[model samples]
Target: MPKPIEEIQKEVVEEFSDLTDWEEKFQYLIELGEALPSYPEDKKVEEYLVPGCQSRVWLYPKEDSGNLQFLADSDTALTKGLIAILIRVFSDHKPQEIAEASLSFIDEIGLSKFLSISRRNGLNSMVNLLKNYAKNPNV
Candidate 1:
């Protein structure tokens, strides 16, 4: 089984604790973004586009053994990293756990301070989508 989301988040926090600077955190986010797989152009449809976002977004959730796994793609580079962060924080969690995650946690991570207004809005949209996916009974 995969580690719990809280453990993953703690690991991320510990990994960056040595940096001790927001700029370094931002650089790390960018690096994470660089590692995200590119979204296929064919997948960029209205159904996948997240509302209130400046860039296109696609999120697909797969449930495995009562845990939710997310596969996401975003048009903007930073948003891809935002998705990566969300995946780190929520993926492998039970649906209830993912649904219960506090959106304010992003602010605590200093993500909002580093992201532009548009990117922040995009992040919000992404969070909503993820939460909704987690809450979906059909899954």
Candidate 2:
């Protein structure tokens, strides 16, 4: 079996814990965003677009055997980084795990504290959409 969701989330928290300041964390986030796999231009259409974000975010999931592998990208660097973290947490897991996993890691990493209200809303939208994709694989 793949690593447990809690382990994946905890690892993310540990990674964030090593950054002493928000500036460092932000830079780290940008690096994570930059590391995301390239998204196909054709996949950038509305069907894959993540709504309610400060920038455009596109998400697509490919199922291999039983695991859900995600493909995502964002128009803004920060949002891209944010999705990278979410992808790291949720990707390559069963649909039920993706839908049910507690996302307390967001707060644990103090990410919410730095987001603007609109950005927070956007993040929530992203989370909901991710779960929806998991639950409705046909999406």
Residue 18 accuracy (lDDT) in model 2: 97
lDDT of each: 0.76, 0.91
> Candidate 2 on 28-60: residue-level lDDT in tens?
989999999999999999998998887899998
Judge candidate 2 at residue 139 and give its lDDT.
Answer: 47
List, residue by residue over 1-139, the lDDT tens digit for candidate 1. Answer: 7786667777776666667787777778778877866656676677666688887778777788889977778766667777888887888889898887665556556677877888888888888888888999355
- Reference-based lDDT, residue 134, model 2: 90
What TM-score would every model get versus the actual structure? Answer: 0.82, 0.96
Go through the candidates in order and give the clash count of each: 0, 0
Name the candidate that leads on lDDT. Answer: 2
